[model samples]
Target: LGFALTCQYLAARCAFGYGTDLRAAVFRHIQTLSQTELDKLGSSTLINRITNDVTASQSGVNMFIRLASRAPFLVVGAIVMALLIDWQLSLIFLIIAPIVGFLLYFVMHRTIPMYGANQKRLDRIARRTGENLDGVRVIRAFARQKQEDERFAEDCAELERSMLAAGRISAVLNPLTFLILNLGIVAVLWFGGGHVDTGRLSQGDLTAFANYMTQILLAMVQLANLIQILTKAQASSLRIAEVLETKSSMQDGTETPDTASEEAICFEHVTFGYPGAGDPALEDISFTLQKGQTLGLIGGTGSGKSTLAALITRSYDPTEGNVRVFGKDVRSYKGTALHRCIGTVPQKAVLFTGTIAENLRWADEHADEQTIREALETAQAAEFVDAMQYGLETHLVQGGRNLSGGQKQRLTIARALAGKPAMLILDDSMSALDYATDAALRKALAERQGMTTVVISQRATSLMHADLILVLEDGRCVGQGTHSELLETCEVYREIYEASAK
Candidate 1:
């Protein structure tokens, strides 16, 4: 009993320990994967790999630890005792063992590939479920809930079909074992009884032979359980290994930007597109901006304004040409160092589940409340934030679902402001605000004075005040000048200005 308890303790530790390590390994690999790699491996599939696949691997570890130290020992000991009783009867043990071994091998070999396909089907089901939950609002707004349900059901049915197919293959192992082992037992009895009558074997000896045969059967059963886990784990491990083996496309540079230049950003002949995307999102886009200069990007939808912003922040490398910062290539800065110098607010405002202070602190880990308050003021978010009873301590739900759109945008801007980044990119973030608030926010941002700023907006008023405005269309800059210069020289700018004037 004490020995059994010890085995259980070791098994638990081994399973949980290996599982914890595996989860960490997978997570770290995910962090190293490029944005393209991440898109290729969907969130649902990655989640499945880290959680369900790791858990399956844990089960394999548990079975190994529990049976490894005990089963072989018992089987060998039992067989040795049986041979002492009757060497002839022990030969029956050898003959049946090989047959059982062959069957177990066949089952394991056949089921491994099936298990791999099953895991992939599981990924599809998990992905569909995640999409359904995350996009529930959009689904309901479109009144496609029933269609989504059908889609989810289809993926789940596929998973179930794969599971059933693998289960059927696994099921054959036990029945085959029983049939062969039962035959071996009958042979042991037949021969042992004859020896007993011939006075070569005692009744006690014959009974011991039967017990040995039963012990061999039990060991084979345990081995079968272990093999089943191994086949499953083999599939999961291969999946995990695939992720680990994938090299990140974005390589980190060893050096920081040059120290002598105040010009914080420059893009030269930049053209870029997603892999397999037929057309370049931005083509031959060249621009330069110094410290304290505000460059406004004005373009219609699909005109590549946001894509240009992504390049400046080094979210991705330009397929052709250089994005430079401080007279050095943007690729020269390490990932964390590159982000440290840029504060960006996306079109959609995203906030985490935390108190207002905690969310702001993600920008500057040690920022004081005064810094936070100042940023909120600059964003024109302080009015509502201070009116709240908790103020900076106000709690937010996931995605800031508890806050209004304009409020979320303001908080997001404030969080970025608090970080005191060297450059700020507002990617159409002012769309949620009223004209009055938008003007106020822009004035406050301009008052910051020395920071380089790039504002991407469709609003003519937003770009009109910028020192330089670039009008984009069809992935190229058809116009690059001040708002007034563009209106005089560029027809596209004239149309946009005329439209917004009304």
Candidate 2:
């Protein structure tokens, strides 16, 4: 009993280690993937693969370690012992074994595909759950709680049906194996009784033969359970392997960037399209911004303003032309080296559950308190942050849900500023703020010497004061020049400016 306990404990420990290593490896591989790959896989499905699938594989490893050797050994040893006692009666073993083997094989073959389909259904359920949680506020505002509930229920029902179908098939293995083994035992007794009556077999030998048959039945039951676990594990492992085998389309470069270059950014006739997209998101986009200058990007909805920013950050490579940063081709610089010089506040304000100071440190881990204060001031967020009871120590809920929209945007901007990047990209991040606050933030940004800024906005007034402005229409550069020059030379710019004036 002590030996058995020790073995079980060791098996659990091994399984835990295997799970930990597998999760870590998958997470590291995911980090290497480009944004295109991430979009293709979907975050919900990736979460399921790392968590639920890994757990299933771990359970299989634990069960295999405990019962893999012992179950088969017991069955084979019992069969050999019965043959030693009475070789003539043991002929029944051949017939029973073939039937039991066929049954297990048929069940396993039928259930493996079902198990794979069930896992995919599980991924769909996970996706639905994530969407509901993330969009809870929108659902409430639209008064669609009943609609969401019905959708979630539908997914759950499908998962239940699939699971039950697979379970029913797996359930048949044990009972059928036992029934065949029991029938084999009765045959042994009948045949052995005649042998005993003829003085060829003893009563004690017959009793031993019956006991061996019982042992084979019990062992087969254990073997059946192990097969069920292994089948599921096989399915889960294939999913895990799919992720591990996917190579990142983007390769990291070896060269570091030249931080002191005068040219901040340059796009040379660049054209880019998302994977599987029909048309290019950005077409023939060419522009250049010198160091410490403010460049504004004004575009209509779906005009590819954010897509241009992603190219500068090397999130996706251009399909046709080159994007250069700090006087070097973007593809030539190491990813970390390039990102270290650029700070970006995306359109969506994202925050984690932590103190305000912790979130700021995400940009620069060693940023001092004074630097944090300066960032908040530049973002026009210092007043509200200081008014909070804990000030910088105030803990934020997930995604900063406790704060209002404008407040979250300000904090995200401050977080980007804490790094003191050479180039800053604000992708419509100021849309939540009022006009007065937006003006104040722009004034603050202008005063920061030696920092290049790219402001993307739909509001024409936001870019009127910029040194250079580019008006985009349908992924094409329709106008390029200072605000006043564009108003004079470009009809598209004149129309946009006239409309915003009202």
Off by over 4 Å in 2: none
**Which regions in candidate 1 have their CA more than 4 angstroms from the true location?**
258-260
Best by lDDT: 2
TM-score of 2: 0.96
The residue-by-residue lDDT of candidate 1 on 1-502, one tens digit each, is 9999999999999899999999999999999787878878888888989998899989898989899889999899988998888888899888988888888888888889899998898888877777878788899999998898898888878878888888998998887888888899999899888988999988998888898889888888888888888999989988888888888889988776553478778889999998889999999989888778899998799999999998887778899999998678988888777787788999999999999999988879999878998999999999999899998899999999999999999999999999988889999998989999999999999999688889988789887888889999989999999988998999999898889778
**Reference-based lDDT, each prediction:** 0.88, 0.91
Q: Write the per-residue lDDT of candidate 2 for residues 89-127, one digit (tens) a residue.
A: 888988988898898888889888888889898898888
Tell me how far the alpha carbon of residue 420 in candidate 1 is from the true structure, in angstroms, after superposition: 0.8
